[model samples]
Target: VTYSRSPASPPDGPAHWRPWRFRMSNDVWGTPVVAGDLLYVTSFEVHALDVATGRRQFKTKDVAWTMAVDGGLIHGSDGPTVYALDAAGGHERWRVQADAWVYSLKARRGTVVTGTRGGGVQGWEASNGEKLWEITGAQTDFETPESGPVIHGDTVYIWKDARLRALEARTGMERWSYPVGDAASCGGVPVRVCAAPDGHVYVVAGTRVLAVDIDAGMVRWHFEAPAVFLSAPAFAPGPAVTGGGVYLADYLGTVYALDATTGKDRWRIATESRQSIEPVLVTGGNVHVGSGSAVYTLDAVTGTPMWRFAAGGEVMGSPVVADGRVHFGSADHVLYTLDAAGGQLRWKLATGGEITGSPVARGGVVYACSKDRCVYALDAVKGTATGRAR
Candidate 1:
């Protein structure tokens, strides 16, 4: 039956939708960082909660678009400024004032490097937030810089003006630059650049997928999609290289497995709808995707369908797997878990608002955040719903 006038309220859904244990009264847009005992999230304030009790450990009033942690240091950004906080107590250690919002945060070998929309990339001392080096004029032609900097070894790789530039991670000096697209394509803004254990850089930019030799900064092989790509391409897990090949999908919902060395197509599978820019994950011999309102599992080797799990709303974030189960959030204020092999619903927990961000599992517990202003800790084993041990 269709809703006549918005109905009395949302359907009750399953009783299992009730949350386990929760920390209340703040919206979370980015994924929660759980380290040792602290769960960190940023909305209008930075919150640190004890994982065992879900109790607030500390709070900082300044907020940011995202936050990250490396060991004891918490890194966060608020537009033109980035803050370094004491992870244990939310104490401000130091802060950096930059030209634009710090979009990418990476900690490498005692240095913190951040990418910004203001056409600048800056490196700072992770211990004290001191500016080590700054590179300017990394301008994008049209699209805002979406992908963050990917560092492999001592080199930093970033995209700007449709080209991929490899720079010295320590000094911000340019080593070499490879045009991902022609000058006509506005220097193909890459969706993501990932590195493999073998030292090759895998890139997905517009309709093309490229494997670059990081040392020489040269394209090893490139594969172009059969369809004209969206200026903003569909999202997939991306450039997942393992064994002998790489896996990625186009905006057209076609997933392709390419020979990692030669860029030859190994297999391709087309899904039901346009796969939006959500991240794709390949693990446990399966390729997991949250496409529109459905999540699908495909065989990693042949691209054959394994199973599909339907959700009540659009799933924008990628799913996480642990202990033979799949966990993800939906637009309809729900967190769901399923048996990885059979696509069977294990449990789903309801939330105060849309569950747009992804879920993280650690230490046998799954943690999720919602736009409605809450963070929930759920039991990963049975979903019988109890938070902490208290």
Candidate 2:
């Protein structure tokens, strides 16, 4: 099919027509992280897509379960063997077998780190994938680690046995640990940590967000709400030092902007539904997030609803904002484009399956993945198409 470029919200027919380049039919667990010309997308398999063509430059499915990218290597864990592939190509540089499957990956200060279901955090060389260091904090502790570790400047953070621990990123040496609430295992899920531009760290556990000074490793402030957190917390654009507040969404779909310095609530808006995906972009004094079957733009400061765009299917993936446009995928098997300022429908492209992975947008192209076993690169301009359909 072919047609002239038209407005995103076509008064009559489709806005633009195109095809998908690759099909990857599986659940996408992580967001598509973009570096430069390459977009790292993971499913049961991890593939590198060219930013301009949406063509598969390489595919690494050795682990096929959990894959994470940091520095220049993509690490995958499938029970015993952890394969680290060169980010540019699918070439395997090194393989290591841990006590169990490595479930998550984190990067900091030229170091690539991962946590295993066996309750061990391992660091590897970012260039050669060699074992740099390994630290077994606790033996599974009756529950496997779930949340991915966060890397601060010189420290790495993890949740082991319901308590937060800070480790040396370069050597995996124990520096300090904080027992947050109780000792009982909250199913061994790692606490989500957000690093402020300042020297403080914010950790989310269940229903509370705690702030800890980097130097002191002590709680400076904390804010608690009725809602429970399941995703990582994100910070808005600001200087890190003044202890800026963090933005978080709960299981109850209530979004709160909290003061970073005091851990006090600045504003709260209830969405009346659960938001599984983390809020993506905070631009122009508004926040963009996918909630149920709609995408919302809220006042960054006041938490007021600015606009909303309805999708044909439920929105599971986070929105990708670039060049004044909001792009996201829906369970309805469509890629939606909307006006960032007015929330007007720009265009909709139909895929063969649900889109669970969040998209990455750069330059004039958008890269996205779907359960239909496909990766698509779309032209940023209206009435244009790129790639081929299956």
List per-candidate RMSD values in Å: 7.5, 4.8
Candidate 2 residues 2-101, lDDT tens each?
3233343223322242333655555655567677667777766787866544556887756456666776777676767777787887788777777667
lDDT of 2 at 360: 66
Worst 10 residues of 1 by lDDT: 1-10
The TM-scores of all predictions, comma-separated, are 0.86, 0.85
Scored by lDDT, model 2 comes in at 0.69
Alpha carbon lDDT of residue 263, candidate 1? 81
Best by the lDDT measure: 1
Report every candidate's CA lDDT: 0.71, 0.69
Give candidate 1's error at residue 135 in angstroms.
Answer: 1.9
Residue-pair clashes, model 1 = 9
Candidate 2 ranges beyond 4 A from true positions = 1-20, 24-29, 137-146, 182-190, 239-244, 275-280, 383-386
Global fold similarity of model 1 (TM-score):
0.86
